[model samples]
Target: MDVRVLGRGPAEPFLGAQDLFETEYDLSMPVRVRIRRDPDERTWTGHYPDHHVLNISAQAATSAMARELALHEYAHMRRNEEAHPSHTQSTAEALYLALAGRRVERRKLTHCYQIANHMKDIYADDITLSVAPADKLVAFLEASLATALADRPHDPPRWQRLTPAADPDITAVNAAFALALCERHDLLTPDHRLYDLAHAAADDAPGVSIERFKHRFKTLVDDPDESEYRKALVDVTHQYAVETGQAAD
Candidate 1:
């Protein structure tokens, strides 16, 4: 893996940890990881699949967050190349509701995206937690969860012209789910706030167990039976919405 640093200061520690990351994650593939300062401060970190590059905001990277962010992005890369599924299923579920003559709130569809991505983050965080120090991981989870809870959107637009695929809440929900999983795995001390945030973010699309969601998400991306997968996904999500009282009659 080739690690490159564009701007100085905040990204230096992330660059320095490149070797440690490779060793810990057993990353053997040739990928270029780039760390740059985000002038806009719009996001904590991001992964660009086309360029195989990871971009970290200057504020996030400088604040002792680079290690975990790197690990998170590394997990995303591995999943993208290996086991990860497309995020389109969430959008599809929303479309299913629309086609069925149900008025789907944009927020509900966005929650669906959140649920799917959060599940993936749980897996990603698992990989990161495996190699990171226990104390550091615990601290990271604590801080990240607090940030997620504080940043939760209280008044999201009731409707939007954009598809659920464009929703930005995935990032917030990802952090919440990561923390919830950390609490579940005893990586962090039990905290009701973490649980609350996780469930609240997922409240719109309820009744589906996390395990079931994980299975469905994986099948949606990994199953060779494309037609069956699509049908099953739509059926399952529609049933879930109806049962949860999220679907219009």
Candidate 2:
């Protein structure tokens, strides 16, 4: 792995993370790490068969979750190398297959992609959680959902209006994903506080059945084939579209 600093930021975090990750997983191909000076730049990892690139915002590189985030992205890299169904199939393709002729609003289209992302995250986290502790990931989800819920608008019912960040319907879906992931790993107890947050999100978005989606996403089989993954993605997308009133003509 080659660490390349783009503008200005500490590369030590990434180096440390790479060391930690390489301790458990083998790095077969070359990896380039780009650290951007801009704090606002989006942090992500791009996986290719020949090489891999990791881009990190200066701000994100300083965060506490940097190592865990790197591990998660590296897990994605490994899966992509293996041609895992979650990494091979494009969610957009599945969305099209699921709602080709349906009348879905442009605004709600983002949610479909977000839900698809949750499915991919589930598989990546499966690898990540095996090596790293789930503490940071779990904490991040709880804090994020709690903040979204607390920042919800006061005007009109939550389902009536959609703000990109604090939309209750999206928050509900996020909570469902969090609950499903945690439950699938047995990370939370029956009386955990996240359950309360999930319940609160469900109450805020009456149109979405959070429990059903939770169960649906939670039972995903491990290492499914390409067809199975696409089928699950399409089924979940269609269900979410219809349940959230996005498929209405």
* Per-prediction CA RMSD (Å): 6.4, 2.0
Worst 10 residues of 1 by lDDT: 161-170
Off by over 4 Å in 1: 33-51, 86-101, 134-180, 189-244
Q: For residues 1-249, what per-residue lDDT tens digits would candidate 1 score against the true structure?
A: 666556554555655556556666654454454445565553333445444566666666676666667766676666555534432234555446443777656666656655645545655666666666656666665566556545544555334534333222343335444555665456644564555555654553344444344344434333334355446546545644554455576
Residue 40, candidate 2: C-alpha displacement in angstroms: 2.3
- Candidate 1 residue pairs that clash: none
RMSD to the native, candidate 1? Answer: 6.4
Cα deviation of 243 in candidate 2 (Å)? 0.5
* lDDT value, residue 149 of candidate 2: 91
Error in Å for residue 153 of model 1 = 8.9
- Give per-model TM-scores: 0.61, 0.92
| Local distance difference test scores for all models | 0.53, 0.83
